[model samples]
Target: MSDLKKEAESLHKAATALRKVSHHTIKPLHEFKAESDDLGALGKLGSLLGATEDIREGMHTLAKLTKQLDEEWQAEAKLMGDVSDAFDLLDILLAAAAQAKKG
Candidate 1:
């Protein structure tokens, strides 16, 4: 194959791998948020843990950042006509993460 073809193939494989792993990467964040919500429900008792709210806020920020990154990536991909299933999967994962933070 031409060097360009080889490079494209490598990039596609990498993107595919990343898309497949995105769920696993984001799963822990969801789990952490769920656990934090449970802990936060403790009301006054939860406050004693110190920085629980900070951690939650940090996760929220992460969700927001993820959303922004996904949006920007989508816009660029559209401009470049480079949209792919792999990136779409990433967008879905990012949206889910953002939604989970809200819920």
Candidate 2:
């Protein structure tokens, strides 16, 4: 159980790190979007057009990865909550059993 807890802690730490990095990655994409908007007029010249497409693709990929990461974190949190609830239920059962034995 201790080992499982340790592993869960490690996973939580790694997920936290990924979340921070994901935010950092999205920040640059926001800046890129702003620049793309500012250069929308220049996109007609065909030079910035390809760059815009590449940035769009990159942003899409990053957004997808961020969503997946978020889902994974949510699932992990729910699993942990369920485990805690199970332990609480077990404690309650044990207490009731002890009281029955005393009575």
* Per-model lDDT: 0.60, 0.61
Highest-scoring model, lDDT: 2
TM-score of each: 0.46, 0.51
Candidate 1 TM-score versus the reference: 0.46
Candidate 2, which segments miss by more than 4 Å at Cα? 1-49
Query: What tens-digit string does per-residue lDDT give for candidate 1 at 12-101?
Result: 665555445545546776676567555546677657868667877777787667756655654554443343444555666767888999
| Residue pairs that clash (backbone atoms under 3 angstroms), model 1 | none
Give the C-alpha miss distance for residue 86 in model 2, angstroms: 0.5
Give the C-alpha miss distance for residue 1 in model 1, angstroms: 2.1
lDDT of 2 by residue, 1-103 (tens): 3444555566556545644554555676567655654555555564745676666566667666766776676666666655655555666676788899999
